[model samples]
Target: MLTKMGKKGSSCIIFSIMLISSFFSISISSEQMIDDYRGFSDSNNSFANFTSAGSSTVAISGEPAHVGDEMIASILVSNVGSNNGVANLIIENLEDGISHSGSPVEISPGSSREVKAPITSQEQGSVSYRWWISSNGSHVNASLSGEFSVEVLPRQTISTYLESYDWSPSEGLVLDASLFLSSGASRPLLLDIFISKDDGPLNHLQEYTIEMDPGRRNLQIFLGNPSADSVFVELSPIEWSPNPTSLNYSTLTVNSPSADPSLLDIECTVSSLEPTSGESVRMKVNLTNNDNFQSPSGKLRIVLSSDQSILAESVIPPINPGVSVSYEMVIQSWPDSEIVQLEIIWSSEESSSSVFLSVQSSVRDDGFALPFDISSALLGALSGIVIVLTGRLVWRATSSRTPSTSESGIRKTRIEREEHSANVQTREIDCPFCEQRLSIPAEHDGNARCPSCSMQFNVAKMGETTSSIDEKPEAIENEIPMSFSTDDILECPGCDQTLRVPIEKRPVQSRCPVCKLEFLAEKG
Candidate 1:
């Protein structure tokens, strides 16, 4: 009996090794995997085999799928070994380039239950995975390979301008994107998505992932706070694929309507009275969302200026979807002087939406101011009136005149005396530079500064100062010098005596010969 038992045991050992080589490490199609078989046949030494049994994973969700969205994949592994030891299963490698981070464990003798792993990663692509099943120690083992791909789609596209919307964004804003399948296909595509907020006190939202089918889809995005900031934002949807496959993506952003706050359909106005030159006189601004997206609750910020200055601002908060909101504010019109953009910022508890509003500035009417300015017509009327008055005075003087020899002689003498007086006065005019009333000898010699204001005036060759800048002094003097004389007076600081210099031999002031004090020469 002992001999017989030994023979049977040896035979069994040989059979086990052969069976393990053929069945323990077998590969097959996805449909062939069974919950009871553990995807392979078990030998006497075989530890675990998987059997497909449990809730399957869902794929192909749309864009803007909420945060923490889950994608679960499940399979069961059982121990076919005779021992009643614990069977530990671990994901050693994944197929389609998928990386699994979680461990699913089970004990075995007969069979272990199904295990599900919740996959979370922003990485897009095919999820390829394989697992190692050890029944007792590391001695008996088995493995199964599986592959699944996920796809994310693009967001819907809007026109360049809001056709008939109520509120318009000050800046064009893009929204978060939706997921899609290829063909915009279904299931088969993997994606990891991340969302973030920018500028204006908002932090980016959390990260999320999902599986999609195939095809085209939209990703929603939005602008930052309309009143406070103007920033570019991103909502990234990344996808990956295994070898022997290619991926597709959309390069265009989901556009918003042109930002025009005046189109907000609200009653907003500006009346700053003495408005700054560069600032825009903002009026009523309105905004309306055509897609009627799910938006947060907050003041509908309408930027008065593309730079977003708060001028005569009014906030319209809690605007609902499919409804209109209004805002009014004045902005520096000089830089933002043109009707550039209007921003409709809607905020909420979870997320926000920014709509672009196209704008056109208010048309101004300056008809009332025309009369006060120098109009050509006014100058023409004045000229005509002056001609009429002068003609009337000349006619009366000529008609009343009577010829007389004695009167003519007296008039001639008086005229001659008047001419002499005028000449004497002109010659006696003092010089402004020397503080002596003088005639304007020639004209401005060269560029000089007024002693009072230190203002440099370029004296044209015509002897007149350019009146564009400096104002005239209080007292007037028609001072004219026949020639500029630089040799007025001089003294040597080194000595206590004065020296005389000619106009041509004018000595440059250096060390005074009398007192040793240094003096710089003046450009006379």
Candidate 2:
């Protein structure tokens, strides 16, 4: 709809085209009298309030043609009565059998009802539709008609292929699912859905078990809640409902390193933030591990205490091995002196040597004070902040408060003494590896060599009981076994059981009682 000024511009151009071609005059008629069609109805007296002053007849620009012909029509109805009134929509639609799809307005007295309607030709060629309006005004306003030509053609056939599936609300949302539809084609198709925790059909496409529409193919399949890049949706002829292909690749990253919130290791940084009384404060503690062997499980225990009692304690779970994890521990100010300590421990696991444990003191005390105004009126406003900062640590009397040291489960330290000169001097010269050391001293002056270490040492004669300063008292005597008489003789290594062993040969290697097994025990 052009404005009045815009219409004037086009009117000037039309006027120039008309003037250049020939001579003509375009003028507005103000003095001429005009009277619309006036005809008396057969039952005009039946309506006592039948008073109308607007035109009833209308002409749509793109109507009066075969079926399926689209038309844009307008209503030009006018009021014919002197009294001001509106034209009802029920009268307009019912009189012409026209179903309106949009807003219909009221037609006032001495005015018009201009409507734009889309006429679609959905019938055979050369068909006509007669449309009109009923009114008590003049015959010309109530009865109006026009016609047009339409050449019909065959309808176009289109197939709606299930190109792919589209997922909305993205990821990390808690919605069930959405609506999917495939229109146009009459044939039926199937649709399938797949969800992968990682990526690329790691979790394959599983068919939907819920009841669905086969003809409408209107898919309302829902997944619980998507937590990935996107779910692969396929709709192909292989299935019935959603024969869709995965249009977009929705990658999934779950159970990855980024999934966990904290970790455990030898040196760890733990952090926390809390309000002591009001003001929030944060704390970070670095912990180390000292153990006999490596551990499989990475668990850390943190105990937080105050001047009089324990505040917070956390048992952290396993962390990646051989790595440092940072934990943020919030240090809440109780508005007093608080003690915080961290204990890091790891348990032994397969393939690892042994577990280790370590504890460290991070926060010894809280020394914060909140400033306040000097007025009592502002006390309430700063009460929370003051207590967290000042009242928490408000000292009653300055006492030499000792630093706290927690009792641990560590083993006692063993004392290590220096080597003494006595054991070094008394160290045995005889070698025990080759059984060269004797219980009874023997005259090992010659033909005596230590089979072990290939060392030789002198000895006294006649198998003595005592020795010199470097010799043992009875090294050979104790080593030699006792002998027996003829009747009590044991078999000897040189003779049979017939040989008699005498008491004088008491220091000797042992001989078998039945056969001579001349071993170390029989020699004297």
Off by over 4 Å in 2: 1-72, 88-105, 116-129, 136-143, 146-226, 229-356, 359-524
RMSD of each: 26.2, 36.3
TM-score, per-candidate, Cα-based: 0.24, 0.23
Candidate 1 Cα errors over 4 Å, as ranges: 1-75, 80-84, 90-104, 115-132, 136-232, 238-524
| TM-score computed on alpha carbons, candidate 1 | 0.24
Judged by TM-score, which candidate is best?
A: 1
Worst 10 residues of 1 by lDDT: 156-165
Candidate 2 on 8-41: residue-level lDDT in tens?
A: 8888878888886554232222212121112233
lDDT of 1 by residue, 1-524 (tens): 44677988878888889888767467443335664466344543454334333322212233332222344545565555554444333342244445453354654666666554555434344334454343444344223333455442332221111112122344334444444343422333333222232333534333334444344455544443232222223223344222222333222222223322322333334454344345555555555644333233344444433334222333444443457655555554523223545554443334445555554444344467554655577557666855675687677555434333132464456787677445542222222444334333243244443455433333344534344423433332212112222443343434433433333544343333334344443325
Top candidate when judged by lDDT against the true structure: 1
